[model samples]
Target: MKKDKPKYKLIIDAAVVVIAENGYHHAQVSKIAKQAGVADGTIYLYFKNKEDILISLFEEKMGQFVQKIRNKMSGTDDAVDQLKVLVESHFQMLADDHHLAIVTQLELRQSNKDIRMRINKVLKEYLVLIDDVLQRGVDSGSLSEDLDIRLARQMVFGTIDEVATSWVISDQKYSITELSPGVHRLLVKGLCK
Candidate 1:
């Protein structure tokens, strides 16, 4: 698969920077290629167009995001601890990659319906992870037995999403990771029995 190639990763990473700096509409294939240190034609080998690159970039980054959270969650069986891990990992990864944070929180939001739909499809895997944690908490009776998994999952994701958007909008003036514990506690309180 093309994803297994080194240039695919380089192109993806470069697309993140290019898209972040230029905004998706203005980001040209040449710019992405230059950022990746490859010829513009090389980009065509891996992607159909700019939209494809944007989608692939998100797919690549979000894949890593889910894997990292899963790895962190492996150390704990407690639903609450797993939630904490998810929250912290979410904040920390974005905090560590400013370009990625910008692409995700800002540029990605400006995408068209088709792009948004594809992005949402990729997001389902992440939302499912949250559903798992909420289900576990409810099963253990730590969270409200009457809790609606779908609603809780939305609230959890929306809260984290809004907070990250605010940070990106403010030019990342504060430490997003520092807000994780507070965010975790607030969400947990609502779901807890």
Candidate 2:
């Protein structure tokens, strides 16, 4: 019900910028409200507290993240093409939204253990998408029949994730999306027959 309100989205988007700039520890609810152009008390109508806002923020953005990747993966025949699309799409999306990258790569990792666990829960959907691609390759005889999909999925996700973190750490000095082809090449070599 609350999500249907315009203020809900306003608060969520505001939280992204606030959390990215201030870090979760220092991002107060009042600041978020001010950024959203709402009363500080209005934030409570949409969220229980700052923690709720943070978790909801992750849930919302990560949900869109997965959906966008899934959309990009659609209508692609070859598993190899699909995999490439996945890498490029992931990089391009993050690169296009630097604030989101900061929120996802940096601030998201700073929460408590329990909160991190919840964040991982959202991340699992994305990992599963990778697994599906690897599984498709194996089934279609494009990838090795003996391929360990679980490990491959982990490696693929790990590579993309580490590269993104490194880019963020390096202040995006280089083109992250431009590295997609090379990253996909390396990943494909390991997956194919």
Q: How much lDDT does each candidate structure score?
A: 0.95, 0.90
Q: Candidate 1 overall Cα lDDT vs. reference? A: 0.95
Residue 32 displacement (Å), model 1:
0.3
Per-residue alpha-carbon lDDT of model 1 for 1-193, expressed as tens digits?
9999999999999999999888899999999999999999999999999999999999999998999899889998899999999999999999999999999999988999999999999999999999999999999988899999999999999999999999999999999999999999999999998
- Would you estimate the TM-scores of all the predictions? 0.99, 0.96
Worst 10 residues of 2 by lDDT: 69-78
Clashes of each: 0, 0
The regions of model 2 sitting more than 4 angstroms off are: none
63-130 per-residue lDDT for model 2 (tens digits) = 88889878877888678999999999899988998888988888888889988898889888888889
- TM-score for candidate 2, residues paired by index: 0.96
Provide C-alpha RMSD values for all models, in order. 0.6, 1.1
